[model samples]
Target chain A: MTKTSAGKPFPWHILFFLGPGLLIYFSVSVYPLLDTLRLSFFHESSDGSLAFAGLANFTKLLFDVVWSEPFWNATWNNLVFFFIHMLVQNPIGLLLAVLLSSPKLRLSGTYRTLIFMPTMLSVVIIGFVWQLLLSPLWGITENFMWNLGLEDYFDAWLGKESSALVTLAFISVWQFVGIPMMLIYAALLSIPDELSDASVVDGANPWQAFFYIKLPLILPTIGMVSILTFVANFNAFELVYTIKGALAGPNYSTDIMGTLFYRTFFGFQLQEGSLTMGAAVATLMFLVILLGVALYLFFFQRRIKRFQL
Target chain B: MKNTQMQKATKTIATLAAGFALASTSFSAFSADKLVIESWRAEDTKIWSDIIIPAFNKSNPDIEVVFAPVPTSSYDSALNAKLKAGTAGDLITCRPFDVSLSLYNKGNLTSLNDLPGLASFSDVARSAWITDDGKNTFCLPMASVIHGYIYNKEIFKELKLEVPKTESDFFKVLATIKSESRYTPLVMGTADQWEAATMGYQNFGPNYWKGEQGRKNVISGQEKLSDSQYVKTFEHLAKWAPYMGRSYQSQKYSDSQNLFTLGRGAIYPAGSWEINGFNAQADFEFGAFYPPVPEGQDTCYISDHTDIAMGLNANSKNKKSAKVFLNWMASSEFAELYSNQLPGFFSLSKHAIDLKDPVAQEFLSWRGQCKQTIRNSYQILSRGEPNLENVLWNTSVGVLNGTMTPKEAADKTQASLVNWYKPQQ
Candidate 1:
């Protein structure tokens, strides 16, 4: 629109438009992240002063028995948590998206709204709701099992060290599945009607059409969904904190990086708050999430080609 | 004639203005002595807003008190940040031992030695607030919480079970309760990990470890928790595990409390802080008793720990007014009112307040009978060490779940302490 701008000096309006947003982004997001990284290199002295410790905090987190044990435990639990979401949540979300995207489906909008309802509620509220439903003293879940003639199978899964993490992961999956469903459904809706008709004309059945045509087209969206899930699963804290508390009880079985970071930052029970160690934990979390996003971008995104439509 | 009238009017206006300024100055002076107190007990807003503040105002009407309450979970961190920033309240509520020590060491709290009310506190209460050098006191000890088993008196009477005095008798009582189809022997809310360590292990440990001397030995590294004395505590805990049932792990603190209040459980092991909540909620009458020791042991020790303490902030501008409030808080009148208001909490002062609550009276009856009282291990352990509460909770859960023996659990806890232990410089 302004050919004269091509011949003019450097544009001022461009910066004028972008300045406020960039400034806000730097102050709120980038600055704090960098500051947290800087703080991770320090340690809190007994006198309540900050002293430079280089990589000592990281070394302790990775090697020292007291710190490393819980660190590794949380890291492992987080991986299991992420894997469960991948194995269970995304697939179910995909199935629901496929069903909801069907032509002439009755009450399709209503079903979509109902399915997405949980995602709209706060994670802490969802955590407490599930906690109440699963509570043994209340016997709600047990009574439901009794009605279904599966009373013997009912156990306090949320309390056992072996099952606590998995139970929490499933709860997270239940609340967040709607997100992937909506994203995939939007991607499915973007497909052209002519393309599906052409696939059918080529003797492809509905299943084959979905597999060869629709699935391939939505691979890019799925890749995006995978990375989103990776970031979210790694950063999760509220649900675990709400239910298992800061200790992530039953011998820290439900402990994840988020809860560990919170405990290290705030101090729980008898532990004194160590801001430097908390920053170190947070820095490690950032590096992990960054590495995951980098891997997804470099490898997964490169393999999945986006269709023109 | 006009000039004379103008002069009279000017004089009258000046007199009125002077009177108004004097009244405003007096008003400012009267309201100037405002004090702020911050605490973690948000639920106790009524106690402060209704009774304590009103009573304090009666004595010091010129001083206005503002109560700032934070949720317990995040209170320590919030207070620590505020203290570091030199913006905390004039009077601050602090956790008993380590947290108080840390704040005192950092010079965030003022010395309370000069307060005349310091004379009223007992040696034990004074000892909890005194520094290691014994030259200064940092806070006024407000109340001591006693931990024990709160059992349904109705259930015990219905079953014809005598109040247990020995470990064998306690187990027999559990067995008798287990024989009943309707009642659970014990209800524990281990979901909140601190409960296992605080209510279960700490309450039971002193009985076997022989109280203060044993704790001092552990602190001095003269003995380890893996030793027979401490291992027996874990063993006793494990012995009581089966009675908690299969679903015990999932039971939250609130759930366990509900079960006990609803008459579904015979016994709920908790602290004196729960007394008010239980009394208000329970339909049936309940009572508390100290956890039993081994049969040969004649004395059982109660875990008596300072529940809450208040200190004058070093940064407070209204130090004189805050001192007046603290003095009142430590007075005999405050003690009587405190015991009446929060019925189960024992007053730490020399003045005796006749406790009306039967549960409070029962706990008091154990005072002379026990050999000695010991604070919770986490309270006595050195600050900056990896949390013993978390370590004990993990090991205790392992012992209860049959994943580890008492010896193994004890050894693991010892190992954790050793890993995090640093010699005092």
Candidate 2:
């Protein structure tokens, strides 16, 4: 039908179909990114003017000790946060998915639903709930520990600089692990049962069957999960904002790029907000994410061949 | 067919005519008699629906009154946004003693210099609310908020301790309290960042004497943070760290307040404004005192009057009604109603009632003797730096955690200040 329309030398139908989506994508997504990129090249003036600064903004962000140190600290902290999610969260989610997928398992649907429930809530709500649960004065956590005869180990994890970042990271993982579980579970279910049956008939155990038969089929999904986690972790803001606040205190042990971006752009107490500096940070963040995504797509993804099981 | 077309045309004309008439009437209705006010105070929906709106409605029988209360945290940014959007309300309430100066300089606010009932307020309150140039009554102090330590009298009685009269007494009491009860002796919350700096203003009176002008001189750039008094103030702040809870950095403002009220802690050092929250306790009531400034210093408290002053939006279409409502708000009757109904509040006007809470009233009485010091800590005055409040907050946390020395923290703070401000210059 489209070829016939093209033969008629008028692509009016295609334009009509694509017009709304194109308009929305360009307006909401592309325009803002381009605008932010353009803004990173300029410096803001005191009398509410903007001047072109070329690489000056980037140089300030990198070489200027004050900005650079905090920026790098936030960046490194963000990496640690992302590392925790990938190392701990994804594996746990994958294992849970495997168990839930077992043929002998009962109430798997219930387990999946209950496990995924936390992910459905907003990040801010989850953040505050965790903060309250960990608060020492409330003693709910300590009480639980007391019941378990481990009260000595109980402390305000969120209040200590040593533990705050890890606690927050773990909380984030607890909320978001369901994402990987659902995605991997879907991919696992798509594998033909006959392949697993063949593996079992060949004297392979359940674990072996999963590794050799089903695992190969779900590699694509794992890659997808990694990329999704990369984007979400980098773009994260709400959880930290709601819990640790914009300052990301405990001597800024929990400070991340998102909070840094907000503080830089909006300026807290003595600092005035600078849009140009904010833009520079944003541009740099975008480049980091883009490079990561590109690496995943071009190298890691292509190597992990999907089996047509 | 012709007759039917003629009938359709007639119907269309009638509809358009009706629409035009409705639009014109609505416009005229909007133009005539409307009073709109914007505030940063959280309007308890029940209270507004029952009390305030109806009272205003009764006073201005023919006019309609619209009340909008924005969240306090986002008030400045939101107000600026509204100003940019050209839809700011006729009357806006803000902490005029602080922000009105810059706002006035920008010509975003209107002056209320000639408004009646100016003579009824305390001179201190009047001076605080008026512009420095003396031509603009940019704000009027609604009430004077006196703040100090809110200690549980029951706890002090149990410990057999007297009220601390000096810095050494303060530490001794904390140590005694901690020994008597294994709970945290002094709970200072630094999570909100602003809460951590509450001690900054409390130290203002002491800093004033030591430096001869305090934060005012520092803000004016006549003195630096390295000055002896400033260093001493930072030292005093460091001393309190030992007494604070282990997780003071992580404890939220509300959390620490809750701990004190629940009898888990001995003292809650906070603003007099918290009287409203503290009054909810039926089992234990708090007592107030101006904690001694230092080892040799006399008791001095930092204080500000309870004030919500109305300013007209430069962009308002209904300026006349706005000014009228502001005048009405500043009236004795309005202040009395607000003070009486809103617990922990006392009017700055001559008509202020004697609140029943002895602790709150004690602070109020002490206001006469206490030296009025300006709020400084770089937030209020530093034009270009980001909030150093968090740095101060973290430093206090570090001191409590035994990770930083007071001198080290002070130098770091001074460096941070230079890093943030010097670049702008």
Candidate 3:
């Protein structure tokens, strides 16, 4: 290591600190991902052997009606799921974060903790609890609807094909909206008070100061929220599995890639699970995620300048 | 940057060394005297721990028996990972297909011909348990579980309806239940693909279509699913669809069961295994009957030779004790205890015990009167085409949802099965 200007040896201690974590990150996350990608190119033999099957899985997924239809359905549903999160969750989170971050706000910590409580619980518990709450026979949802004077509109939304995906998406959004709220709240907190005061001194109202001064600075955080939402939505499994189950029912209207991968990989009822097909599905998911991340990194992320307060 | 790269290299090497050390140590540790058995059944765990282990420990006290209980939902993936790692317990309980052809081809299971108590099982159970070749006998036929529709006798009586012994009579009662009784006429949930099979296809569909010889005929090219009877089953299913629960295609299994158990629905078609659940609940009482056959069909109820069976591990170190356990499983003693525990569910063993549930007793009395027992079509098709069961179930859901016509559904399933079986040919 080179000597510093002070005649001390260069600070190599940071490397020693980061080395273990970096190794673990690569081995546990990065390596398995690459390995799964590699395995997708191969098919298993009749005698428990494997052979290189380049482009076969992809081609089959596209051309073969049997595979293509279900795969596309899952992919489309996953997109719908992600879109719902973006539309419903992010805006709501932003509003909550903004309201809670108000300087004059009272009991902010308690509100923050309580609002985030659902996110702290496991996805499995949330699923079953919601299932019971929504069951028509149970009448909890119906009771709530009656209270709202909208009892007629309260069908078992979880059971209808047209509504199941949206219902589940909203449930998921309800659970995770806290993450975005907290993140944006922290970003808002970091913004110097001087900047807002200056904007107010220039004859700006509270709303104008927020829209003109604070909003542009927090674009990076909102972008981050969007990217995180995208990832979580695409990778979602437990909620759907716990509630709708592996079949993703109501004619598979709620089926996403996660449930599809599970059903294909494990083989249900009579369909024998095929490992090669499962690997192929995984590879597809990896590609979709990688592509999404790449687009964000190259386009949206680079466009958003992180303003220093 | 240079210092960081050097440090990263060292860390990687250290991790590799540590992993290697752990692997070698665990390798030796695993070779020691221990046998692990994994099963999805929680009830079985208690039996193994309380009853069977003591009997096993009596003979082989040195070898420890470890139990791994897996949840039913995730058992497939959990078992697969364990199997791939070659650490899936010394023995694992499996459904028929998993234990039979799947494990056989994977070479993960061993034949159990040398084990004791191979001769005592009923021939039907024996034939269903073993591979077609005599070389592999992975499981001992444990018990048989019958499945069909369960209706509320009290409700039927209140409606002034006799047990619907024919198709038209069944529909008339369902319409009455829907219109007059302020309850769902039928509780059918196809959300889980298996649920629909339990209701329409597995027991009722095949028998109505091709009767007892359907599988053999389909195998020999003597029958096709597009035949008239197959269409009739779909037509009848469609006719009754309106009376089924709202959005029956999307209803989860438990939700549908809840609806029926809570008295929201008048009829529930489910597996006979649920008799235990109904029996346990004091607030409700229900009776089961096969779905009524079409006119002149002569009342054939769907049946299967294989029920829940247990087999000894071929790799088990304590072979003698494992046999004793299996022998105990097949014995009248085991059947008696199990029947006492779950009143309505049937066992292969000839030991007749008094059933606790009156509804179950009544159902059993009608078994001979109907004189029809149709084997589960999916179970039969599972022998040759691995994908057949899923295709059939998925297609049945589609048909029930009006997504696919009965003929189209049948064709799709047939084509898929043909493709799947092509490799075997």
Best by TM-score: 1
Task: Summarize candidate 3's per-residue lDDT along A1-309 as a digit string, tens digits.
Answer: 335666876678988999899999999998988887877788876445789999898898777877888899999999999999999999999999999999799999999998899999999888888877887755488888899999889876887678889999999999999999999999999999999999999999989998999999899999999999888888898899888778787667899999989877776544566678888998898889989999999999998877766
Docking class of 3: acceptable
Which lDDT value does model 1 have at B98? 74
lDDT of 1 by residue, B1-425 (tens): 99999999999999999999999999757656988898987877888889989998997888899899887877887887788777798999867777787788778889998999888887778777777777888899888888889999999999998888888899999999998757989888567766777788888788888888788778877788788988888988888788995588888878888888889899888788888888889999999889887888877898887777889999888899999999999888899988778876788888978888888888777777775555546455636446776688888877877778999999877776676564311
- What is the C-alpha DockQ of each candidate? 0.44, 0.36, 0.28
TM-score of chain B of each: 0.89, 0.82, 0.82
Off by over 4 Å in 1: A1-10, B1-34, B84-87, B379-385, B422-425
TM-score of chain A of each: 0.96, 0.96, 0.93
Candidate 2: where are CA atoms >4 Å away? Answer: A1-9, A41-57, A269-272, B1-38, B43-54, B77-90, B96-144, B182-184, B200-212, B245-249, B299-301, B305-308, B339-357, B378-380, B420-425
**What C-alpha lDDT does candidate 1 achieve relative to the native structure?**
0.85
Tell me, by lDDT, which candidate is best: 1
Model 3, B192-261: lDDT tens digits are: 6676655677656655754556656665556665666666666666665788767565467777767777
* TM-score of every candidate: 0.92, 0.87, 0.87
